[model samples]
Target: MDTGVEGRKASRVGVRVSAVSKTIKGNRVLDGVSASFPLARVSGIRGHNGSGKTMLLRAIAGLISIDEGSIEVFGEKLDARGDFPVGIGFMVEPLELWDEFTGLEMLTLLSSLRGRPRENHLRSALTRMGLDPDDLRRIKSFSLGMKQRLNLAQGLMDAPRLLLLDEPTNALDEDGQEAIRQVLIEERDRGTTIIVVSHDREELDRIADVQFIMGDGRIREV
Candidate 1:
């Protein structure tokens, strides 16, 4: 809900995927895909199940190795063997969180890992996602929607330069989904390069500066 951050342009450095290919269990997931995502804008990808959308995101996050080709973020190559790419925040398909930890605590842990302060940004991110920052309930007690919100909170807490979210609006009511859209719009305006995968075409049309349609292990702009 803060529109003040709007209009800040990204520093013109973004991501490039060149001839990326991946295979799992003898099935081709990404077949020589290549694309460039501009900074400070949102790129939306829409696809059916098993269309390799999530796989592509994981590869960009360096969570999985590509069978061939390369991914570059801000002009730097992403290596799975190296530390997580700096200024990158991602929420792929399988989000792992500590069940016993409170929402705030979970974000605190991530902030610690990134060597950043937690108190302010943690609360801000939670509230922006329509969750109560003061709630002390364990993450295990959260509903599906709340858990999804928490997943988003953690990704946004670090103020990442490059954000990758898959099915970001899953398990949420319209209000909650709208809140996320607004947050993403603000982030995009402030020069945070973002890539989102969603089944909702309306959401994609509203937010994505460029759109990609994925099918049969290949991605193409529409």
Candidate 2:
């Protein structure tokens, strides 16, 4: 299958947020947060609750508009209305899955929407996430770990160029967490840029090429 588009000329092929800030309901969330998540490496963001970590991820994912500063994915500048930066995938706090669709069916549908070739790519992603591609159970029937794996499979199946995962190991045991870590490392080796947000400092330290700590809406390299 053809991998998506390639060769976007930029100083880096990943996410760049500059002096970005946001406010929600008159409350400041991101206070001049600036960071560069480089291509082909895993960059981790560690922060406590309400520290603007998830908000930063949302801004980068084009899920919300920033009240100040700019965000660029690859080499392209982003605005409120533009299509989500191409070749990007994200798994955030609450996933909205079609409870009626079987795991493979969901993958097939998403691939169709994304214009990605199905077959090998979708199955490979499921396998990588330790999910059985042939599992015919509907998403509502899946256990917590199974649901998490399915969420991951959806994000990774198309081989996105920039992957943003928020608390990727939220519902998994040790083995499941290790599987995700390995997959992330593999993705990095294959030139897929990654930005992960987790409270697990040790996990970030173990896998991240660079690490940042977010606090009270501020971000700094650690």
Candidate 3:
């Protein structure tokens, strides 16, 4: 597999939010946030509910309109800047997939949109995530943890250089959470930058290369 030339100036995009602030109606969500999520490191976003954790992730993902600020990904500036979804993957608001499809099926279908995916990639994702391949049962039949693993599998099928996950431990047991954490650490080790929004301070301590604690829609260095 061609890993591409390292350090080559190929329009590489890194997540950069500078002095970003967002307000909805009359409530402020993100207040003049400025941060840089570099390439190939895991950063944790922790905050109270409605503190703008998810909103911040969404803004970075280009899912919402930014009121004010600059968001750059893969090195491309976003918000009237240009396209920056080159190598970004995210899972939030529940892994949306065909509940009728198998885990592998979901991975292939979702990844194929990005490009060709290898059989080993999908299979390896399943194996590494501790999901039994034989559990080819419909996604609707899988438990929350199983579904979450499937979500991770699909997101990783693209081999994204930058991936963002929100509240990743939402529906997993201790073992399942550990497995997800292991995969995240491995991703970081393999030069994949990751940004995860989690409330589990301990979990963040385990995988985060840095931490940002959100308060009143603003991140305070902790």
User: How accurate locally is residue 123 in candidate 1, as Cα lDDT from 0 to 100?
Assistant: 96
**lDDT for each residue of candidate 1 in 22-89, tens digit (9 for 90 to 100):** 88899999999898887778889999998988888888887888888889999999884434787888
Q: Candidate 3 on 29-105: residue-level lDDT in tens?
A: 98999887767777789987899999888888777877787887767787633243667778766657798988888
- Clash count, predicted structure 1: 0
The predicted structure with the larger TM-score, 1 or 3, is 1
Report backbone clashes per prediction.
0, 0, 5
TM for every model, in the order presented, reads 0.90, 0.91, 0.86
The digit string of per-residue lDDT tens for model 2 on 1-222 reads 112243223326477889998988999999998888878778899999999999999898888888899988887889854346778878887887899998888889988987876789889989999888888888999999999998998889888899999999999999999999899878887999899999989888777877899999999987
What local lDDT score does residue 64 receive in model 3, on the 0 to 100 scale? 80
Against the reference, the lDDT scores of all candidates come to 0.85, 0.86, 0.78
Q: Scored by Cα lDDT, where does model 3 land?
A: 0.78
Q: Candidate 3 regions off by >4 Å?
A: 1-13, 80-84
lDDT-better candidate, 1 vs 3 = 1
